[model samples]
Target: MDNMKQLIKQFSALITLSLILTGCVSLPEPIYLTDEEVSIAAKVGITEQQYRVIKTSQLYQLSPRQTDQYLRILHEQEPDLRKRIGRIAEKNIGQPYELYLLGEAPFEPYDSQPLFELSKSDCVVFVEHTYAMGLTDNWGDFFKTLQHIRYNNGEVGVVTRNHFTEYDWNRNNNWLVEDISSIAGENTIKTYEQTINKERFFAKQFGINVPQDNVKTVETYVPNEHIPAVAQYLQTGDFVNLVRSTGKGAWVGHVGIIKVEDNGKVNVIHSASPAVRKEGLLEMAKSFLAETPERFAEGRTATVGFKVLRLHETANDNLKAKFDGNVPPIMMLNRKYEYLTKEQVKTKLALMREQAKKDLIENALEQSKQSDIK
Candidate 1:
C-alpha cells in the first residue's frame, strides 16, 4: 500500500510537469525586428517618392506606446472642444454667417480654418475635428468654429458624406464663387469650388494620394455565402481581394490596400475619415447584404465593390534600424523616449503564463472536488 501511494504521487507529478511544459511550448515567441530589418521591411516593394511621402507623413515610424498616447490625448481633448463650441452656439439661437462674421454672434467657426491654424499635425486629428464633428446637425456651434476658421483663412478640404449629390456641391460651391446673384447663389458655389481646388492643391503639395475614381463606387463580384474567404483574406491582410455585397448580387468588394496585425486587428489608411479604425470584414459583409446568417447560407446576394491601391514606403531604413535594435519605431516617432524592451516583453509574457497556470490548477481542483461530491 505504501509503495502504491508513493507511485501515485510520482505519476501526478509527471502529469503536472507535462502540462506545464506543453503550455510553455505552445506560446508563440515574441518577434522583434532589428533596426536593419525594420528599414528593409519598410522599403520592400515601395518607390522612392512614395517612401519619402511616408517618411514625412504623420503615420510614419510610430511605436505602439506612442500611438496609444496620441490617441489618448485626442480622446481627452475632443470632449472639451465639443462642449465649448456647443455652449457658444447655444448662446446665439438664430444667427446667419454674416452675423457671426460681423462679431454680432457669440460663436466662431473653426472648421473653416486652414490646416495650419487648426493645428492638425496628425491625420487622425484632422479627421476627428473636421468630419466627425462638423456634419452632425446638433453640433452647429462646434461646426461654427470650423466655419469661422474657414471663412477667416480658407477651407482646408471638403469631405463628402456617404453620398455625392448636387446638394452636397451646392453647400460650399455657392460660397466659393461669391455668386449670391442666382437662386443657387454664385458666392456659395464659388466658395465650394475654391475649397475643392485648394484641397487638390494641398493634397498635391503634401503628396497625399487620393483614392482612384473608379474605386469610389460599389462593385460586387463574389458569391453571397463566401464568409470564410472574406474572413481569411482579412486575417491575412490581403487587401486586394475584398468581398462586396450590393442589393442586386454579391461579388468582390472594392479591393484596396489593407494593413493587418495580430489580435484580429485590421485598418485601412486611405481617403476615408477616422483613418485608423477597427472594422470587422464579416460585419461589413452582413450589413452590406442586409442578410442574416441563414440568408447568406441560402445564397441571398448583395452588391459590393473592390479596388486595389499600391502603397509607397518612406523611412524604411530608419524604421528598420529602430526595429532591429528592438526599439519601437512608433515611440521614437511620437517622441515617447521610454518604450518596452525585449527583456520587459519576455518578463510580461512569463508572468502572464504563470498566472494562467495558477488559474488552470485552481479550476481543475474545483472540478475534481465537485466530481467527488457527485
Candidate 2:
C-alpha cells in the first residue's frame, strides 16, 4: 500500500513537471538579466531590470510592468503629445493583426473576450490601446482610459460600446480628436450620410438587445484620388478612418494613425489582416484604387476615401486633469483605486457595469418624463 501511494505521488509530480515544461502552466518566476542584456540596457540608457521586463514580453518589447515605466520615459523624452502618440504606435509596428480582439471578459458574461490583449491587435484595438497607453503611465489608468475611449460615457457593456465608427466612436471621442475631413480642402473632399441602426447591429453582430437607433449624418471624406492634396494637411498622430465603397453604401472600413515624416511625407500606419505595417498615403491610396476583381472576390473591399481627425491641442492636459481626480462621474469613476488583483478588479467592474446600465436607463426615463411634461 505504501509503495503504491509513493508511485502515484511520483506520477503526479511528473505530470505537473511536464505541464510546466510544455508552457501549459504558468507560474511567476524571477526575471534575471544576462550580461549582454545588461550591456544593451546600459547602452540604451535604461536600467537592466527595465530592459529585462521589456524583453520578457514580445508585445512591443513591453510587459505590463514595463509599459508603465516606459510610458513615463516616453513622456519625459517627448513633450509633444502628437509626436509621442506616433512614437508609441511605431513601437508596435510588427504586432500581429487580429480581429475582434477585445471584449468585457471576467467583468461581464456578455462577451467572453478579455479586458486587454498585448501581443496582437485589430485596427480599432490597436488605435485604442495605443492612445490609451499614450495617455497614461500605468496599467490601471490605461485600462480605465481604454474603457472611456471604447464605450459611450465610459460604460462597460455591449450596449454602450462604441461599435459604430463615425456615429459612436468619432462622436464620443471628439474631446481627444476633431474630425477635419472637411478641412482637407473643398475640392479634395466628398460628403455622405450613413444611417446606423444600432438596434439591428447589436442583434446581428453580438446577439445582444439594444433599444437605440443612430445615424452618422453628413460625414465628409477625402476621396482616394485626392489623397495627395489631403495628405498635405495631415499631421502626425492624426486619426484616419478608411472609407470603403460597396457600390450600395459606404462605411469606415478600417482605421489607422497618420505619421508625418521629417521630409514632408505623410504615412498611414495600420494593422491589416496579415500584420501591422506602414505605407505612404499616396501609395496606399493608389493601391486601394488599383485592387483587381480577383481581390474583391477574395473578400477585399475597395477603400474609396478617408475621414481624418486631428488631435486636439489640449488633449494631453485635459487627460491629465481627469487623472488628477477632476473627472466628471459620467466620464470616469471619479476616484482612483490603488492597484487591484485580477479577481478584485473583476468583481468591482461587474458591479460598475450593472450600475452604469441602471443609471443610463434611469436618465433616459427622466428625459422621457420631461418631454411628456413639456
Candidate 3:
C-alpha cells in the first residue's frame, strides 16, 4: 500500500494501509459494482446512501485507474506540453459519452456551467477534462484549472461559462489558448465575419438576458480555400473547431485536437457520433460537402468549414522540442494501452476486492485515520 501513492509524502506509514488501490498497467475490464459489490464502499468510508448516489450520480462517476494514471503521468513522464496533452487523451478513448450532464451541460450553443468529472463525459467535456489534466496531476488543482479554461475571468456558473468557442474561449483564454487562424499557415491568411444571436439563444435556452451588443460578432474563421495553406502550420495537440454555416446563426459544429504524424500526415482526436476516435483531418474535409456542390471544396460531408488554435504560451521550448510535427499515436501510449488477459483480469479484480475489504476495516478501526484526498 505504501507504494500505491507518493503524493502526501508528509503522512506517516500509518495511512499506507488505507490507500494503494488501483492502476491500468493491463487495462482491465472496469469492475462495475453490482449492488452487493457497491456495498463494499461502506467499509472504505463511504456510507451506503453515498455509495448509492455514487452509482446513480451523473457527475460523480470517475475511473480510479484512469484518474490515477493521469496524475501519475503528470508527476513523472515527458515534460513536453504537446506530448502531455496527447498522453492525457489516450486514456479516454472509447469512453462512452455520458448524458448525465445534460441538465447542466457546458458545451451547448447558448449556456452551460463549469462542471468537472474525471469519470464519464460528452465530446466537449471529454476535451475539457483531458485539457485540465494536462495542466497538473493533482485533482485539487484540476478543478480551478478547468474553471479558468472553461469560463470567462475564470468564473463558474452558466452566465460565466463560454458557450461559444471562438468568442468565449479563444478571445478570453488567449493567455491559455491562442487562435492561429489568422496568424499561422503557409500562405495568405483569409478571415470571415461570424455573427451569433447570443441574445436570442441565451434568452430562449436558459431564460437569461444577453444584450444585442453582447452578441458576439467578431467571429473570425479561415475560409475553405486557405485550409491547405494553413495545414502545414498546424501542430499536434492543436485544437481545431469545425466552423459551420447554418443559415439561422453562426456556430461551431465539431471540435477536436490535431495530431501531426512523423511522416507529416495530420489527424484529429474527437468523439463524434459513434465513439471517441482519432481520424485524418483531411479525410473528413473531403467529405464535408460530399453530396452537395461544395463536396470537392473544403467542406466536410455534413459541416461547413474549419479553423486552427494552439495552446498559448510565451515560453514554448517543450512544444518546439516535442512538436517536431511527428506525433505518436495518441502520445506515447505503449504502457497505458497494455491489457490483461481474461483470467489474469479476473484474478486481479478478485485480489483488489479482497484488499478493499481489509483496507476499509483497517481504516474504520483506526478511527483517527487521516481523511482521504479527493
> What is the lDDT of every predicted structure here?
0.33, 0.77, 0.58
Residue 250's lDDT in candidate 1: 35
Candidate 3 on 1-374: residue-level lDDT in tens? 67546545646443553453333233334536566534445334455555544344322244544354335434454567777777667645666665424323444333343255554566677677767677666565565566666666554455566777777766766655677777654354434466555554445455554445434365556655566667788887788888766433346766888778789888888766556677877777666535435542434343556777877533123322343633122111111112345565556446656865886699786765554421
lDDT of 2 by residue, 195-287 (tens): 776654554455554555344476888888888777888899899999987554678989999999899889888999788788899998888
Count of clashes, each model: 74, 0, 8
Residues 1-374, candidate 1: write the lDDT tens digits. 99999999999988878877988435445455446434543545333444333333343233333323323323333344333222222222221111111111112221243322221123222222332232222333334333422322222233322112122322232222111112222221111111123223223332332332212222223332344344343422222334433233333323222445456544432222323233555555456545544445666543342322221122123223434733221110111112344565456446656865896699899999999999
**Candidate 2 worst ten-residue window by lDDT:** 328-337
Global Cα lDDT for candidate 3: 0.58
**Each model's TM-score?**
0.23, 0.71, 0.59
Model 1 residue runs over 4 Å out of place are: 1-113, 116-259, 263-277, 292-310, 314-374
Give the worst 10-residue stretch by lDDT in candidate 1.
329-338
The numbered model that scores best in lDDT is: 2
Ranking the candidates on lDDT from highest down gives 2, 3, 1
